[model samples]
Each structure stands twice: as structure tokens, then as C-alpha cells.
Target chain A: MAEEVENFEPKIVAFLCNWCSYAGADLAGIGRYQYPPNVRVIRVPCSGRVDPLYILKALQNGADGVLVSGCHPGDCHYIEGNYYARRKFAVLKNLLEALGLEEGRVQFSWVSAAEGERFSQVIREVTESVKKLGPARRMVKSFEIPKEIEKEIAEA
Target chain B: MDIQSEIQKIAARLLKNKEVAMVIGYGAGSAPNRTAPVFIDKEKDVGKLVFNRFCVNNLSLYLPRLKEKGKIAIVAKPCDVRTIVCLIQEKQIERDKVHIISFACPGLLEKDGKTLFASCAECAVTLPPVYDTLSGEAKEMERNEPFTDRVADFFSKMPAERWEMFKAEMEKCIRCYACRNACPMCYCEECFVERSLPRWIGEGSEVTDTMIFHIVRAIHTAGRCGECGACARACPMDVNLAPLAKQIREDMLNLFHHQAGVDPNAPAALETFKPDDYNDFIK
Candidate 1:
């Protein structure tokens, strides 16, 4: 809510679905893959399990970039869940780009349980993208709204 | 091609399922000209099922409140389908807990013979393309106005007039939270307006309070509203609030490339922040 101090480490929230992306991340860890340490993962059952509101809430609550990874097509633990995510992300990607948000802020990719290396590569890429864009506090336009409403919004 | 018979048939089958506690879909109202969301739990109620343009409510919004033990099957239009997808994505409801019956959805009928909503008319695609059951004529996608063009035309009006329009529309609000309660996305255990700790909104509500409620509600809806018209339909006062909600939904699409209820994997605009997110309006 104030001036950007030096040495600020951007906090990225990565929502990884348990069936695929989570296992992929664990694979990255087990293999000792090196990537930026910014992302904090919230694991769910499927990528389709990640709610768009939760992504918005994370951003509003001061997260910088959110990466959602799920099983590749046809591999979802729940059949066709990722397909629904694909349709949703297509629109979401368009909306994010239109808002003038940096293209890399909300990244989506298919990472199966075995794609450990691909998961690491994605995290590295997302980190690089977020790094070039810099700190994202300006992403929200709600600063000037009244205090009462601000309190309510913060509560939201 | 009459969908009423099909709906009744589905309702009958749903009621017969011991696991299905209810089947929430459109039903004929007391009047010929109106349609409403009907929760059918008993076999006798299957006769109430109806399908018509006046059946504009997105019955899926009633999903989150239902007890999880019983399966609930819902009839969804393409637009309503997105809401169902969004709900499942958010973990507000489990995907396996409910069933979906859908239509390729020729879009909403205005009860005046119109085939689509103003937003639906401009929409570029049909989604969640698969369904548990299908109904109506499978409509082919067609080109129409762009969402932004309609928005620009709407906003080109005088500012004071626009404010007057909003104020007039909002004056009809009754603090029923019918709109909130009718929304599938508004599944918070304790909604912000209901909290007293910081008292987000004073409970001794009035026109001003009501206005604040709607305005903030619209803002909160920013990218998440699906334009189901559930708010206006549920409103006892008929505030005709869909226009405002639709605007933000379009803006979210036009500006942020985000559509509420469409995708499970994609992050919402404010949810997953980018370091360089557009904040031109922030002071």
C-alpha cells in the first residue's frame, strides 16, 4: 500500500491441482530442479477445482501472479475436468490481456504427474515473466473507494 | 421440438432417483407469461416443469445451498453452464455431487420473441459443450455486435443521466439479498454485508444503504458475474439490475479476458495478480 522498498521479493501464489500439477511439482522437488522461490502452491483435486474467485481474491490480497496447473487433457482424475478449465482459461486469458495486465501474471498450463521437468520450466518461465513486469500493487483500482467500503472489500 | 415434455420427463426421472434430493429447473408460474425456478423433490411436482423464454433464471444458482447427500440435476443454458463450471471450480460445490442437463441454448428469449440477451447476442462461443442431456434446437453460432460496442453505446449517454438511471434502478432494492442468495458465486459462509465486526455495511439500511449495497455489489461482481439475470428475477422489486451487472461482466471480458463461471483452471482478474497489472485508476 506504499512505496516499493528495495530488495522486495514478489510473492507469487501458485494454485496446483493435486492429481497432476501437485505431483509434477513434487517431482521437480525430488529431482532437485532449481527455480524461483516466489510461488506458494495451493493444491486441489483438479485444475478445474481452482476457483476463479480465489485467484482474484489472492491478487486483491497482495499476491503477485498466480499460476494454475492441472492434468493434461484426457488425464484428469475426474474425466473432462481439465477440458472445462481449457474453455474457462481461454476467456480468462483474453480478459487478463484486455485489462492491460502483464501477459504473464495469470499463467495456465497442463502439467501431468510425470511432467516434473515441464513444471519446473513453467515456474521458471512464470517467474521470469513476473520479474520483468515488477511489483503489481497497481493492479487493483479500489484504493480510492470510501473507507467503509474499503473495510468491506478487504473483508471480502 | 417442444422442450416442456422433455423437461417434465427429466423431472420425473430425477424425482424417482433415491439419491436425487431435488431437480431445480424452470417451471410455469401461476400466470402464462411468467416462468420461475422450481425445486422438484416430489413426483407430483414434475408436472410443474416448463421451458420458455420467460424461464430466464439460472437454476444452477440454487446448487450450493442444497444438502450434499442428494444429487441435484439442473437444466442449463450455455450461459448458465458457465456458472455451473465456475461453481465446481471454486469448490463451492463438488462436480460429482450434481448432474447437468443442458441446451445448445439459442440464448435467452425476452418473452417478447427475441432469441438472445443483449450480451448473449454478442457472445463469441458456446461452452461446456458436453452435457448429461440435451434439449431444444441446437443453435448454430452466429456473428452479432461486439460486447464493447454495445458498452460504448450505453456509456455514451450523459453522466448525470447514467447516475440517475442507476439510482432509479437501485432504489427498487429491498435488502432481501435475493440477488446474492440467487447467485451461485456468492457462497461465502458469512457475506461481507452481514458481518458486524467491521460492519462493512450498516444494517439499518435505507435507499442510500441499498444503493451502496448494489454499487459495491456490482463492483464486487466486476469479473465474476455471469449475466444470468438472477438478481433482477429474484428481486421482489424488479430493479432491472442486469444491465449494470452485464456491463461489468463485459468489461471483465473486454479488459481482463476473464469470464466468470467459464473456466476452472484459469485465475480470475483480481485473484491471481501480476506485478504489472493495470492500476491506472489507483491514487
Candidate 2:
């Protein structure tokens, strides 16, 4: 179990807004800021584009952690995208928490296009928080065949 | 006059005046403990309209479904009126297209006819918030604590224990969309669950699928659920969905100071945002 914990690298899905967090990540790449590579980033046009369904789908599809990063308040390229996103994510996060999901399984942050260092720090913090919680077991959908179906198939 | 006779007289007057093309109200169900929604188009059918303890269904659910049927008058409980307000606020129904007929609700009974619905115990509104005409007089009834306050016991449990409880409740769901159908707020043209291109919910009653369905539904109804208890009563599996609804309701009130169905003109909590809203959850 000790070795398992040591070797278990968590898979984190990060949805980054195109105008800010995505560019922030690009800056991080250009500046050679070291950060964990476990996060797979999906760039959306705006933070508002990150539907709660997308986050839940990521968690359901076996991702250990999910992160959504957008521009700071009043910094949205679309004028008020992140403001709306902030409300949406706040409620989504609260709902997820109420359903008994671990505190770190889903994370939200605001990273501007110039904040490369902050983006790396945010990723590292999110990754460490998720690592402590371990793999997500709640709300994950396993695609394995049922025991009854498997037995029937074996017989056939 | 009794509530039923008053309701019938109102329905007859509305139909006789041709003010409403149809009057959607409750009629006797096959069982004594149940009431089914009935549409009264002619004055003769006004006698069929009844308002009793068995009138538990949220009649506003049919407004959006029957939108093209022309102007309609609905017999709504005070709680049901909240859903109509929510629908109007969401632009799902036009306020002018429908007439609301409500009365002082005496509260509703469970299907067994012996116990009061949990929603009734916490009900705060005895008079409809917005109505074209109100019928029977409302007598003040003692109200208990808010539903969210009562669910604090469930929320206070350890996260792991709460998860176990949620999982247990979710496991009992047979994936019947009765809860969705019964919900007035769930009037989406294409529900995410039924979309095949990007199937939001799994095919069968897998625990994960059921959990996601409820989670998304709760999110969808967050500030919009009127606490009408229609979804819980519609569940054939007897799964208690009140905890999740109450939790979202409490969060909406705490975070945005918004309650669903209270004001027809107020914007929905999720549809609009305040620049200085709470962001303590964000990093």
C-alpha cells in the first residue's frame, strides 16, 4: 500500500480559458517554469464555456482530479464571462462538496495571461491536494462487463 | 364555502367567461389518496375540478408542456405557484399567457393519507406570491424550521458518511425519469441525459449514472427548485431527494441571497452574476 501510494501519479484534467489561463500556461511553457505534467489541459473560449457537465464527465471517466482556471474577476476577455463562471463554479463546487466528494478532487482558480509563475504554483498545489486524497472512487463510471454478462459470454 | 366547491366555482366562472381556453386543475385519482391533473375546457367539466389533501402534484409542470394550447388558467397550490413564478422568471412561460388560481393551502398528505409531506412541514408561503385571482381564504398555520435547516443533521455528518448515505440513496434509483417529468423546472427541449451525441448519463441504472443524473438535475434546479416536493413524490423507488435539493437551496440563499419562485421579475441566481459575489472557494 505504501509503494502503491508512492507510485500512484494522479491524472488531473484542467480546463483553461483561452484568453487567460491557456495563455498563462503557454507563458509557463515559454519561460521554462517547472510544474507537474500530470494535468491535461483543454482550452475553452471562455471560462463560462466549461460546463459543469464537462467537469463531472472528466471525473466520471477516471480522472483523479479536475481543475478549471479562468481570468481574474473583471478580467474576462468577453467582458463578464469569468464573472458568470465564478458563480457557476462556486455552486458546482459546493454541490460536489455536499455530495461527499473530497475537497481537492475539483479545484478552481483564476490565472491571468501574464501569471506564468502563479499558474505553475496553482497546478502544483492542486496536484498535491489531489495526491493526498488519492484516486477518485466516487462518481466514477467503470466500463467493465458485468459478472453475469461475462459468464454468459464465456459460456457462449 | 369548502375549498373544493370554491375551486369548482372559480373554474366554472373562468370557463363560462371564456377567459381561459382551458382550466388545468386536479381531479379525483383512482385511489382516494391520489389526485390527478385534469384539464377543464367546458363549463360542464368544472364540477370535476376538486381541491383536497390529495392534490399533491405540482400542476405548473403542464404549463410549458401545453404552451400551444392557448391561454390557460391553472389551479395551483401556493408552493406550485412558486414554480409558475420560476417558470415565468426563466422565460419558459409567459405570465400573460396563463392565469393562476390559488387558495390557502391546508397542506398536503402523503400517499398513505396519514402523514404530512415533509415539504408541507417546512412550507412558508400559504398565499401565492403572484396570482390573477385567489380563491379560498388562507388560515395561518404554524410552520416549522426551513427544510435546509432540518437537513443540517445530514450535512453535519463526516464527508465519508455523507457520501455513503448519498450513494445508498442513489443506488435505489431505477433511472425512471419520473422525477424529471414531475419537475416544472426540468422543461428542457433536449435533456442532457437523453442526448446521444454526447450522452451525459449512462445507458442503464448504474450507480454512477444515477448519481450523475441526480447531481446534474440538482444543479439544473439549484435556485429554481421551489421545494414543491414533486420530484420526491414522483419517485417510484421511494428515494429521498430532499437532502440534495435542500443543500442547493441553502447554498443559493447563503451565497446569492436568492430563493426560487419568490419574485417573478428577479433574475435567476445562475443566469446572472454579481461582480462582488463570494469567491472563497477559488484558489
- Compute DockQ for each candidate against the true complex: 0.03, 0.77
Candidate 1 lDDT tens digits, B1-283: 5777887787687778655778888877777657877888898888888886676677777888785646788888776777787777767777777878776555455445543555566554554444677765566646342222334454565544554555566566768898888877677788777877755554653444565466556665656666666665567776656556655676676556787766667765545433333323111
Clashes of each: 17, 0
Cα shift from native, residue B11, model 2 (Å): 0.9
Q: How well is each residue in A92-126 modelled by candidate 2, as lDDT tens digits?
A: 88888887888889999999999999999999999
Candidate 2 lDDT, tens digit per residue, B1-283? 8778988888888889888899999998997788899998999988888878878789899999898988899999889999999998888889999999988777777767767777787678877888987786766656443232335666789889888889899899998899999999999989999999977878798988888899889998988989898898899998878778877888899999998898888888998999999999899
> Please, what is the TM-score per model?
0.57, 0.94
Residue B164's lDDT in candidate 2: 88
| lDDT measured at residue B92 in model 1 versus the true structure, 0 to 100 | 74
Where does the lowest 10-residue lDDT sum fall in candidate 2 chain B? B142-151
Q: Considering summed lDDT, which 10 consecutive residues are worst modelled in model 1 chain B?
A: B274-283
